[model samples]
Target: MTIIVAGVVVLVLGILAQVLGWGAEHHEAAGHAAAAHGAAHEEGSSVLIKRILVSLWHSNLFFLGVSTIGTVFMAINYVAYAGWSVMVKRISEALSAWVIPGGVIMLLVFFIGRHDIFHWTHDGIMDKLVNGKPNPHYDEIIAGKSGFLNLPFYVIRMVSYLVIWGAFSWKLRQLSLQEDLNGGTYWFHKSITASALFLVLYAVTSSMAAWDWVMSVDTHWFSTMFGWYVFASWWVSGIAAIALTAIFLKQAGYLKGLSSNHLHDLGKLMFGFSIFWTYVWFAQFMLIWYANLPEEAVYYNQRLGGFEGRYTGLFYFNIAINFVFPFLGLMTRDAKRQMIIMKIVAIAILCGHWSDFYLMLMPATLRGENGFLIEIGIAAIFLGAFLILFTRRLASASLVPVNHPFLDESIHHTT
Candidate 1:
């Protein structure tokens, strides 16, 4: 209970601090832009406002669509695979719940800010052509792809993903609970079967989700590894989140039986996955860079050219923060055991997630301009909502699965 209170306080204060700080900085920067561009700035402001609105809308849509899918995955998995993961399953279920209300808010933000992000929302804009040719950026490719990308199909896919993910998430949770009551090997076997089924479904749906949400922004450039890239990011971040939250809960007198061994395992996974994420990121970039194909190169070109030094700097920094830090910090068994050290590494992992998502979204969303309050504001809103959901869900169940067959194994687990 106190843990929840503390989280709320921290969230409020942190958001307040960030909002005030970033808001002021953004205002000042906007003033400079206005001065430099003069009246043209006013004219551009109209366009900028429109663009921002679109961006906000698209962002909201993306979040809602993805969160629903994620939540569904958890729900169904809960029903289907209630055994093998009965112990560690709550971690993923909690995250699925986190996405629910947060997803709604994200959708609202997208609707409200529609003009800022998406080009397709413009009226009759896709029909226009340049020199008897439709502009690829404005209409041609995206428009052509609209058979699949149009609003209706888009919503349909979103719903389908949500249904699949939510079912999996819920069922997995349900079956785990059922096993506690029924005490049957049947449940265990069923769960294993379900997990296998869910994994295959997850692979396909997650890939499409990534393509629609992130990769489509570039439109022209496509990488086969993108889905895996996003999976690496989310999977690592999700594990890190579980670790951080688990640590917090344990500190607050929840999850009483959890031991340092669990923490050590979590730390090791975090370290390992961080490296995995780096590998995927590099593989994608290297292949594209080496090929130097116009389609592939354009994506990097936009980041390098549009963002100037910031994009490149951020690219390297992501590697260092997400990969190098973990590699060095969590390598020692002693370090993982030390609460203070674990806290710092945990915080780093969280920030790495933020940066990872930022890179995923921003280079494609903003292109050239420095990120501003709207992004921060939207993120805060999502974070607050997620925290609220996470804490509530955490409270609704036992900190650890008391009836899990592996409970003894996990408790006794040691090097």
Candidate 2:
């Protein structure tokens, strides 16, 4: 409750500052008055609301991505019939509980922020001419992609992804809990079948989601690997989250007898996927930087040196902190097995990825750029809420899945 109040105080005060135009005045002092207006050209009012929505959207999406991956982790384990995760399965389920609230927040922000966040929603942006008269604000690029990027279709896709993923999250949790009571293979087998279907749908929706939620912010730019790129970041972060939570629970005696062997596997998965995220990040950047296509290269150009070099520092920082720290910190076999090291590295990687999302959204959406205070406030709100839900869900469930067929295996598991 204290966390929630602090988060709320920060969130409300931060937004009140924006609503009062304090944000605009700050950017004006930096001589970005025109840039600030241009940033919200289609806003039809103050840019303040847009900035609030953008920050909220970023925070919600970050939490949502991590939450969604919890379900993804569970689904993958079920499909592969992997038993090693039985001990930490409840943690992942709790992490996934955020999807319901996250999705609702997403839908709310999208509507209230339509004109602010997505320029394509404006009346004439898609038209070369209105009534055969040249529309001064027409965007040829966005117009060309109108078929797939239209507001109606985009909203439909977003809603579909959330509903389907949320249902699976809730249903899967119920099935797992039922397994605790029934103590048979029936719920377990049902989970495998349900999981198999979710994976197939997730394979497509997750990518489509990346395109809709994150990539579309830069409506003019598209990448072939973006979906996988987003998924990789989500996957690695979810793994780190699971590992971190397991450690926390063990310390609290919620997960007693959790061995170094379990931590070792978690560490290995985190290390491997962190590398995977690096690979994806490098592959996208290197390919774009090398090919130097005016269209494609512009994406990096703006991020690397554009926007008055506001994002320049973060661009390089994004790669280094995300790739370097994880690689060196978690490289040793012993490092992955140590509780203290695992906790530190997981916290660092989670923070690194938060910055990763900042890089992804801030440059495109909040070009005027407010200082970090508001961002911190906004993040605190979502982070606080997510923790409340996650902890409650975790407490509601049995720490160990006693009825799980692989329970004995997880207990005696070795690295």
* Each model's total of backbone clashes: 39, 0
Using lDDT, give the best candidate's number.
2
Could you give candidate 1's per-residue lDDT for residues 202-266 as a string of tens digits?
87988897786667656557899999887776766666676777778778877766678777777
Tell me, what's the RMSD of every candidate? Answer: 5.5, 2.2
Off by over 4 Å in 1: 1-88, 106-115, 120-138
lDDT of each: 0.62, 0.84
Model 1 scores a TM of 0.78
- Segments of candidate 2 deviating more than 4 angstroms: 12-40
lDDT minimum window of 10 residues, candidate 2: 33-42
RMSD in angstroms, candidate 2?
Answer: 2.2
